[model samples]
Target: MRLDLPCLGVFFLSVIPVNASIRERLSYQGLFGCVHSGLLDHTGCHHFLRTDSGMEKTKSLIARIQFGKFFAILQSYANKDHFNYVQFSNQAVKMNQDFLEIKRLVESIPEHDDLASELSFPSHMFQLMAHSATFLKDTSNDKSRGHLSVYHLIDLSVRILALHNVRGVLDSTNSISEEKIISLHRELRELVSTFVHDGDSESIMNWMFQDLAIQAEQDLQKLWQQVSVHGIACLSKTDQQKCIQLP
Candidate 1:
């Protein structure tokens, strides 16, 4: 592609073959380092990653960047506005399922108990919330509690880890907005906050857990009144009730 570097516009290069992948010319290093950082603009690094990387490559890069930015947003800022209750609750369920699987795989090791305990919350969140909430209700689909395919399990594991990094920020920062942090846990159905209480009390965790019921009420809004929202209430309703349970 022959074009002006100083005046970089969205215009395409006529010299390059129309079918060529843009990754042929674009470099992640140049994009990451030389591109003026976007922190000054609320858009941040999103625009820097945009390019004509052909249809497939562009789609792949967009997905990766979306998840990357999503993680970064959660890590750097607790955003209650982006929280989806159904999605978060389902993830909580899936996380439980994943913990069980991980335990099964590590059963022989002596430290497995410790690791399994450490993993429980993350795993429950994985099983219930990781599948697209829109796609999860079908009950017959591959991702439903009944089916729980391997792909679903693997994908949930990855997302829980990404979200874990996001929540891990709570352990380090003093400036995270209390309302925002509380909103996140509430949106996740107040399940994550359980782990926050198990050890030395973190000021941040305590703050996040406080006012949780109020946050959940606000976060759940009208859905709280709906009678049909029964299947996933109060975390572990399935396991405790002896309903259709995942092994």
Candidate 2:
């Protein structure tokens, strides 16, 4: 499926990965770099010091990103006609069920002093999934156009995942433990590795989604760069040099 957004083409082209393995590795590195660097500067990373509030927010952000990445992988498969109506429908049903459970969990958290509002399952997200499920169920009989519908579904899913309010949370965070971040990075790498080696369909899908993942990583990099550069610029010349020279 072609994206008509002009800016997106530039973003996608800029971060297109050489292959799935490289893309996965870059993602791991990007996350690690962002979390570490973000914590160094008081302006951006200080928020993470609030362990009680920050931990919950960070976990929710990670979970949301995982959901987005998973769907992006699915989109790549749908784009290549790797999924039939039944398989795609089953996956959608499962995703919706998972989302419902997530919603319940989020709602169970007391609102007194929690980040429940910020971390709650988006209502529109539920609506989108429900619509996709119905569309998949109703169109199961049409084999010829099934791929097209699935492609649209994938597109919608990706779009939702890409929403600033969703995946962008990570870009704005300053909290989270180094160990926790590292562990999440490792999990993402393992997930990507599994997709790359799973089968021809998944291998191809990984390759196709690599560009999308890279674009997302690049955005995070840009955020870090913006903050780091500004912070460095505010320091005295010697201090700036020292900051720049720090490994």
Candidate 3:
């Protein structure tokens, strides 16, 4: 969704579930029980942040995959058959060297003043979100609402990165076809329609989570402001109307 949307001119506002709870609402401790930012770049973690002004890939090619160690945690679980959200998230937090490596790589990068911070995920924390989301997705445990809260975190992270990918395209691109826009919207809506969440918010974890979670939401608000700007100036009058209606 992130990689493809910029080329099509930010196609999936429809990815947002029309539901009120989804409309309403993630961080490190705010992270899943065991999740952390681990980029699945074009090479791995959810396509590592594209560094070029949130624009689409200029050239397309698939990276070779070796099924990195992160994959091992998925199958190597102690329980094998079932685990709760805590069990799931902490699975990586254990003696997994790859998880540690991914965290180090994601968090070690200092912020670049040259880039628009709003159009980026802080410390690439989205990798954690993606990692946790992937893990949560594979597990069979939907036991309590905790899974939904974790998903809420993932969904929030996806939007933040999605905005990053779509940053400048609406103002700069004229090639995006109306048909492409409509098709992408329909495809996205169909995909979104299946989402179901039932829960009150989960309690905040440690101070680390609290700090990161606050920053993430603050960052999203800033990006929404940017989107609102483009929406008001949108080329098509109907598109402008949709922009004005953005939550």
Clashes of each: 20, 1, 14
List TM-score per model, in order.
Answer: 0.24, 0.39, 0.33
Q: Give the TM-score of candidate 2.
A: 0.39
Model 1 per-residue lDDT tens digits across residues 20-42: 44464454323323222322332
Count clashing pairs, candidate 1: 20
Q: What is the lDDT of residue 136 in candidate 3?
A: 59
Provide the lDDT at 55 for model 3. 18
lDDT of 3: 0.34
**Model 2 agreement with the true structure over 6-97: per-residue lDDT tens digits:** 32223232222334365454443343333323234443322322323324324344235335534545655556735654555565565555
Model 3 stretches astray by more than 4 angstroms: 1-142, 168-170, 173-213, 228-247
User: Looking at model 3, which ten-residue stretch has the lowest summed lDDT?
Assistant: 58-67
- lDDT (Cα, tens digit) per residue for candidate 3, span 1-247: 1232222232223222233242121111111111223333323322232232221221100000101122233334422434355655554344244434433543443432232322234334534644554555564355454444454443443333343334433344233423233333333322232232112233322221343455554553454455545432233532322422322
Which ranges in model 2 have alpha carbons more than 4 Å from their true place? 1-53, 56-59, 62-66, 111-114, 119-131, 140-145, 164-167, 170-247
C-alpha lDDT values of all predictions: 0.34, 0.42, 0.34
In candidate 1, stretches whose alpha carbon ends up further than 4 angstroms from where it belongs are 1-100, 105-107, 122-170, 177-180, 186-247
Ranking by lDDT: 2, 3, 1
In model 2, the Cα lDDT at residue 63 comes to 35
**What lDDT score is found at residue 100 in candidate 2?**
53
